[model samples]
Target chain A: MSKKINLTLKVWRQPDNRTSGRFEVYPAQDIDTDMSFLEMLDVVNDELEKEGKDPIAFDHDCREGICGMCGCVINGQAHGPDAATTVCQLHMRRFQDGMTLVIEPWRAKAFPIIKDLAVDRSAFDRVISAGGYISVRTGAAPDAHAVPVPKDSADQAMDAAACIGCGACVAACPNASAMLFVSAKVSQLALLPQGQPERDQRVVSMVSQMDSEGFGNCSNHYECEASCPKEISIKNIARMNRELTRAGVRS
Target chain B: MASSNRTLLQSSIVRKQIVAVTGLAMVGFLIAHLSGNFLIFAGPEAFNGYSKKLHDLGPILWVLRIGLIAALLGHVVLAIKLTGENHAARGGRYAVSNSRGDGGFCKKTMIYTGILILVFVALHLYDFTYRDKTGDPTIVEGVNGGLSLGLFGLVWNSFLQPWHSGLYILAMIILGFHLSHGIQSLFQSIGFFHDRYTPMVKKIGFALAILLAVGFISIPIYVNVVRTPHL
Candidate 1:
């Protein structure tokens, strides 16, 4: 048997950082307790539109478990206390009636407040560009078997490569450090022979750029991994440090 | 493209290693610095005398100083180089599309704060360490109990001046920002960081960073405000 639940929603609303931002509350009832979090938002938006009030604005797409766009703090946990998926993947079945939901954007110095629920995450792209890509020579594409990378190294690279570049890291970070993201970028590439040319410079340049962006240092808050929908390991950050050190030594 | 400017910046992995090691070394320096400063409670003779002893370390001190300077320079330069490369990439934020940042690691996200601390470092080196050694910081002699050589007086005077104390606090705040991320992540970067120990490490790192921030700032605050003789 399914029981419809009632709840309160206090969500941050702002047209942009320039204007005043405030939290607005609404009494929501008759919601399917088994709906995804976004589904719950959808229900609220419908109610708001019917009442002729402006519906809350939020970032989400591909209601599935991929496409790192959906975000909200259900109670306090990013993406609502689920294991390795984003908030869009979160279902209301996990919630009880009369629960209060607080939705806010990722807060950080580098991530400027963008509308009600969106943040400018360009800084991350810049960090990736710093050395995230590998240089491949043009001509006949080499056979996949030609590289001869060890299986474990390949697996490790794939694991690090799984990062979706969501700013959840910056948002979850108290100091807003970006080591995890930078490290992920570095580790994934460094593990493969194809990434050797750029590996040294990639780690060096990306790490340097990460610092210049005004982000905080990584003090190892696993909130990033905890908040990560993919559940990326904190070990990648360690790998980045190692690479940075290795890069530093030969530089 | 010929390995010109691109190559120089990208030349060696050793350079990156130097930066990381230096960063770790600086942390070690902070610990030693704190312990030595505590000698103030040891009475003026022991304290100022300790400073003199450090100076008395002589030729060996010069070598260490050179090494420290080299480390600092290497770290800073590489850091700057890396920063430029990141900016050159992507050129701007991603288009407003269906990309939700995935969940894996939240902390992989702090290159910005790490950079901010770099700026703070320049200001700090200029203000405290450099100024003190040169006596440009206003060192006085024979004021406190023994060998008052303006060391204690300089420290007390700087903190009491409000602005100096504020700057000291500001530097400490930046240091706090750096350590809060660095210490915990250092374990991660080094690879000992794990799922079971991640939470413990985070708490330990945060606590230590906060403690250092508070302790270092307390010196300037205490000397400048509460510890003022008139106060």
Candidate 2:
């Protein structure tokens, strides 16, 4: 049998993006240790609903940790304190009974809080739309062997492709830089042969979009890599730098 | 084409490259300076001769001085601009902030240490380069057959003061902290990364920081505690 524990929750509450937010205390009773952190929040919301109070608002989807829809700063760490784990995957067992958890939304000028925890991540979409895709024939899938990707390049590309578009990197960075996210997007394409045609334009456009959206410059803090659920390497950042330089020289 | 080139230069990454390049140039200047300062250990004759040789470079010395000043200005101005942008990016402060242990004290405190070093450099130039101590008893007149600026005597007298030596030692330690993170970061900014070589570079950065700090500190310690003034 899994052990049961209680937690004192201090969650940020705001009516809308236009309003200022403050922490509101809520008691979480009999939370199972095996319960995921979001599940524990679910129980708290249920209790609030039963009492005819406005339930706490948070963003979560595909509780399996792959959707990248769920995340919040838990006790000063993005996606809780567990390394390489998303908020949906974080379990209550990681915490002690009666511990106080301070939860807040991703705080960045680019990611404004919509209500309480959910922020407008449309900035990332804008960056992606800027030049995150390769132009190819859309009707049919190309044969795998036709591309002739090198094994080392394929593996590196796969590693870079693991980013889930989660804003944890922005939340974790002291400067709120999205370099890790932008770099990963750049590296995944730059390392592949299929990404060759528009490679220069892609990096330049994406980086320009990222900056225009008000994200900070990378200071090489490596905090994004530390807090990232995908454990993305900062080497991707260096790769993006090289790509930008290549693009600049060509232009 | 010109507009695109201008855009590339204005981009955040390119600005960082500028900072990194200028920072490395300053580090180069520091290394050359520390090497020249080491000649003080060889006694006043050799030390003053080295100063005379540098002064004899004349126009070349002016070129170097101008280049160093340009690098310093570029580093400072661009760093301040980026720092402001970084501050604005994070719209609000975290009520309870904590580090993930990724960047330690030295990495996070770059601006503070850099500012301190800037202040120290100004004071150092004022004390040695710009100051006139013509009538001071500590001055060794007619040194290096009157061909040198009595730089050795100036340095020796300055370091002999406990407070002056202490200030220099403190500034060197701050510079060490700045370079420890800076040396490795410059390579990263320039897009140099490798599985084996990056780690090696990091180690070299740390070792160089310690070496520079210790080397610079030794002069003051020797002057203040080790060497006895001629009575």
Question: Which one wins on TM-score?
Answer: 2
Evaluate every candidate with DockQ and list the scores.
Answer: 0.11, 0.54
Q: What is the lDDT of candidate 1?
A: 0.68
lDDT of 1 by residue, A37-59 (tens): 88888899999999998888788
- Listed for every candidate in order, the interface RMSD values in angstroms are 9.3, 3.0
In candidate 1, position A111 carries an lDDT of 70
- For residues B71-186, could you state the per-residue lDDT of candidate 2 as single tens digits? 99999999989999999999888877878855489988999999999999999999877876343634644443433336667787788778989899999999999999999999
At residue A197, what lDDT does model 1 achieve?
Answer: 83
lDDT for model 2 comes to 0.89
- Model 2 chain B poorest 10 in a row by lDDT: B140-149
User: Could you list the CA RMSD of all candidates, in the order they appear?
Assistant: 9.0, 2.5
